[model samples]
Target chain A: MNETSRAVGWKPRGWDVLNIVLLSLLALATMYPFYYIFIYSISVPEEALKGVYLIPRGFSLQNYVHIFKQDNILWAFFISVARTVVGTVLTLLCCTAFSYGISKRNVPFRKLMYGAVIVTMYISPGLIPWYITMKSYGLQNNFLLYILPGLMVAFYIVLIKTYIEELPAALEESAMVDGASYYQMLFRIVLPLSIPVLATVAIFNAVNQWNSWVDNLYLASDLKLQTLQMLLYTYVNQQTAALSMINSNSTAQTAFVMTPTSVQMTITMIATLPILFVYPFLQRFFLKGLMLGAVKG
Target chain B: MEKTAPRKRKIEVPLLVLTVPFFLIVVLFSYVPLWGWSIAFVDYVPGRSILESAFAGFKYFHRLFDSTSDFGTVLRNTLVLSFLHLICSPLPVLLAIMITNLRSGRFAKFIQTVTSFPNFISWIIVYSVFFSFFSIDDGMLNKLLYGTLHWIKEPSNLLSDPRWTWWFMTLATVWKTVGWTAIIYIAAIAGIDQEQYQAAEVDGASRFKQAIHITIPGIMPTFTILLLLNIGNMLNVGFDQYYVFGNALVQEKIDVIDTYTYRVGLLNMDFSYSTAAGIFKSLVSVILLFTANFVTRRTSGRSIM
Candidate 1:
């Protein structure tokens, strides 16, 4: 292609060039910090601290191994995983079912159900009251506390309802005319076409649940059931003391004890990896879901 | 044709039955706990019977606004932080617009993915990232500045400085959710009819002029709706992130309403007082939502309700 032909297309001008540069710079600034930390996690502690940018000076898996060495870290990891899976599935089933019901014109007491859901969304009984109620219900120190409270989010329901409302009513009508009952229509017609939205809500909810440590920190006094984020918090707070202990021992045996900073990064990576892996798969749907929700609101 | 002669009003038993679980869950969790709002008026002890508890009507609320409560500082922090976010939130909109204007689709997608990567990671991870960049000794930010020029003996404690913590919180928050927020605006812009832009261009408008006249006006409704919706949640700062990021040095500036409630209720065991504060926040949110909805209906001919 000739330069003039290329320029005739969308070759950016002066201001556009500046915009691109500034944007890329900001993107790098936002992104490369995490990359630096990721590299630091795998590098030897001292060298990592010395501003080595290319790669870890002395490459190692010892940091990840040290994180694995801690008791309950693995258990907390599993608990977090279990919480994400169970909480998301439950949220999907209940919220979607309720939303589907409310969206249908023929559903009984639809207005009342719709009002209840909206009320729940807009007027939460505040944190303290909820905490007190959870305590009264004897949910303290239990895994159910984390999973149950977040199982049915109203905003997610509204999003799903908005999406379902846009779906062609003729499909459901045709299914019903063919002797498919309400349940049959729901499962066979509604659920099948709702995958894009289901995946979108599922990914968003899963990320939220995985990152939710506050509920556990508030309710679960038992360390055994703490989520990964809570464990990471504990790790951040204890890093200084850990560093001192490592410095005290000059022997090579202590080299195996990875720096707490490295462990901190690893914990962050571990907590974030699932979402990162699942994001691209669901990104397009999520953006669409959010736009529809925003526009409808 | 004869089958349609009598339109039946059939009872939806299966639908009702199918919806029973939703009602049960809502009643159990939402409606039942709603009754616990009575605790705001009394000295609510978790283990004690509700009947036995002393009914100190308005006493806890009085304490919340009293001089001893540090209530002024907490409210001020929440308002300032939220107002600042309301202003700063538009930066992401601009970023999204700029990215969409770019010629390279691959670059736009890459920017979107990486910027949103932070949102998936919890505040704990953000805190760790902050430390990596701002830690006194080993931080890249400090090291790079120090290496270039010996400005000071040690790196400045960016997170600990009360004057700077709120901005740090905002930066961390924006870093995480900017792309997520931008995606909506981008979609809204995308949805604008292309014929309008063509008309503007055909009328001899420049690219910038076309954007200003055609594109922006088209997405005005989306912008207004989002603005109103965001206003509803103005007081609800991310408690987990703030609590994780806060420390002794920066607590004064960063201690928002949510964190304040947690500290008072869970840490100090002042349940009744904290409940009052929490109720106050929720009440404000409800009012904002209603007011915004009213304004939107009056001006824009649309309503969130």
Candidate 2:
């Protein structure tokens, strides 16, 4: 391709330099906010008050130490981890089994079930009804609220089903000939072969479960059920309110080293760090998942 | 295969047993909510069964159109935000074209990775990061504008200003989503025939000309499909971004359909009114979806559904 382009006399132009420069600026704009927050979170509270733009002036771990001392933050972190692990596992199992069953040509009521599932991809009953229905199921303030309603996501089912349908039919046929039960075939042969799609779905669901806080905000109001996202949300609101109050009353400053701004930025980093850690490795799956979704649509 | 047909028939029951539970779960969670739409039509008391509630037919629905209701402001906010989003929808396509045009593969990959990072984090974190940058007193932007540059006499709180809320929220949404959205267009661009590009190059076309003539047209179908889907989702301006950014000062400007429903239903305990608002939103969404699908089929000879 490079030789062909060269043979065609394609040469670098001024637009290439302009494009690279402009996109680099855009990337910088996207990244600068996170960098600013990280520096502010690490700066000494008193020094940060003078303002932090690029780098920390007097480095301190006081904000992190203070937030780590808070039991609620620890508990929320635990809840977030628990929900992501359980939610992703349950979603993968249910969606995989459901998709596998529906992928078969002769499953009873296959079209009807598939149609029902696909219809949900376009229409939602809106927020009030969804919340009311969940409340009626006694899911309010329950941890099950996080995992139950999400288990059979229609999009995941469609992705997995499309993958299953594309697999070589001979493997399943051979397993059947050996008298492998349907469950055994699904767990042993098809599930193993569907790892790529499953990995894609797993990453999507895990990120979703970790990042979601609306359920924790609305359905599960119990303090113990708060996830890290919810805790960060509450802190954001609290800090905003407090900042306004401090603006009005200049005497509200405390002698403590852990300022609300520092603590808030710390919590924000805590909430985001996990995704940042996993993102580079899992990004290809996200791209593949998007293409699969687009193709399916 | 023929010999195992009899055994396959016998296995059907177990298959049904394996899948039926999931089917039931989907039905209960997804379809049963449709039954809750009835609450919009009646006087829905919280403890009472929806069927047993007093039959005040269409009272709350009428209230949605009543002059005293907040629905007007809510609808205005929803439409304005959706319109802003629709007008800016081409940004991702432009980004995709630029990324694909880059000669350095490593640089293109780095930019894609960095830009897409924001999409993975929660809106709460977005709010936090924005606050650190734009907060009035010690915010980075304020510090630069007032303290360092002396460009402004007073620190401006972009987060709290109602006038800029719509534009600010739209910018935030675009920043968060543009890179992720571009991935679809990138995939579409990849699917374009390589021969077409070679032919264009052989004709002494500049890279810019090739991109304009070939790449953009190649992704137009994908772009149209996504745009139509966005139109279908116009009423759903999403709950998280607005919810996290909302405050008393900007509440009027940022209260879209979803947040309005939440406030009235969950916060105020006005279950019936909220359900009515929800029903209105859902009905309009379905209508818009069908209309978009119709337009797509007419224009492209393909249907999303």
Candidate 3:
């Protein structure tokens, strides 16, 4: 294991060094920000204000503790979780129904119906019109505001429809010959075969529903109804003056002091971790979904 | 074509039953909003039907062009930010190339995964990371620059400064999606025939030369397709980042079309004025899509359609 023998087998040590160094730098660039924020969240106020707090200064769970203790945060988390689950399921259901019907090559005016969905992909009716329409539907300040308008995404419908189109028609033909109705075939045959794509689309919808803030910003104004993303948005934008009220807790004297920065970092981590944790499980399906688009498109 | 096959109209009954709800919903949600664009033509007020509203054609359109609407500034902000994003679009291609060039397989994979992780988190969370790094007076960057490096006298308000908004927002967006965006290019690279690289190796081609001659050209079609799509979406920059980032001090630089529409239409209840702006934006987007399609067809002999 001499240096000269090691050098003999490898062709370009310089290139390897450059490659490793550059990639290492890039890795750090992408990763260090998360590390920095985590350190800041856990760092004591005095140490955070002081020199180079790379590691946690005092090792405190108080910031995270304070975050869950607040009523606003608890309610916001529940709303976000509920909406994400509900919105994603409804969206998948709507997309599956529409795409399943249209994917049938024999359906009359199928192209026209598919064209209708595609046209909306390129042309939004414009934001003001959209807002007015949503308000007109009496969704303003309602929980349905988060779920109803997004139930049928044209793009996802197109993707699912394309996936369904690729399935062997013989499966449907045999099922039909057995006197299976369209509903029975779709649920029993099409959906079971299309699970990979369905999972991918579901992941996309769930992540989107959880992450969405703009709809909440416009449609849900009641303090009681704001989702976690909206709460995070409000905190980030410094629009809410109610943050100071959290500090008024009597346990503040007994506990490590909680700052807005600490609470925000904790909230951001809480909102972010669920998606990040689930991402590895979904990445394979997600990449497969990407292939579904790429191969057909 | 399949005329000999059984025409099962009965199956369609259930299929149509399943699909009809979505169709009606789309008509209500999407088509109704498109019809709302007509508000730009009239002095729309609450409680009055659009037909009953006076037929004041282009009145709000006129306001859009006039200084009263501040439309010029909004257009400038939107176009400038989008243009910046367009210019930086090639960075993803560069990143893909760099990753492919790396000799260490595990290291390259790790970098790809770490970079794409940012894309999973929404922009609001991105803002928190950004705030931690750049919030004025006490921010990490300020602490390093002023306290440690003696770079400047005053701690600049980097977040709210008009001068920094475009670059900052673009960096924020690019930072989040660059690696994720690079995935398509990586796929393009993978799709390139391995035999070509083996042939090049036998011809005594260097790695750099191989990348130049084989890898870059291999992904050209994907590059062009993405470029055309980007051009088609030139006017469709959404309001999330700008809405979250814009402040009173930097309002002039960051008040893009979406944000301006939200403010005027919803906040001020100036429905007619905002609808006019929305109409203008949509018209530009439609024209750009057509133009992009035409140009792509002319050059590459392919169109998005």
TM-score of chain A of each: 0.86, 0.88, 0.89
Q: Which candidate is the best by lDDT?
A: 2
Error of 2 at A164 (Å): 1.5
What is residue B166's positional error in candidate 2, in angstroms? Answer: 1.0
Model 2 DockQ vs. reference: 0.49
Docking class of 2: medium
Q: What is the lDDT of residue A61 in candidate 3?
A: 74
Worst 10 residues of 2 chain B by lDDT: B1-10
**lDDT tens digits, residue span B58-133, model 1:** 9988988888889889999988888878888777778777877777899888887777767667888888788877
Off by over 4 Å in 1: A1-12, A100-107, A161-189, A242-255, B1-13, B147-153, B199-204
Q: How accurate is candidate 3 locally (lDDT)?
A: 0.82
**Cα-based lDDT at residue B90, candidate 1:** 74
Interface C-alpha RMSD, model 3: 5.1
Residue-by-residue lDDT tens digits, candidate 3, A214-260: 88888788988988988887776662354576777636467566666
Candidate 3's displacement at residue B290, Å, is 1.2
Candidate 3 lDDT tens digits, B1-305: 12356656534566677777788888888787898998899989966788899888888888888866599999999999889998998889888988988877887888888888888888788888888778884577788887888798978777988888899889998888898889879888999999999998766666666888999899998888888888888767888888877789999999999999999988999988898999999898889889988988888887775
* Model 1 lDDT per residue over A8-78, tens place: 34633765788789888878988787677778878886666667565776888776776666557778899
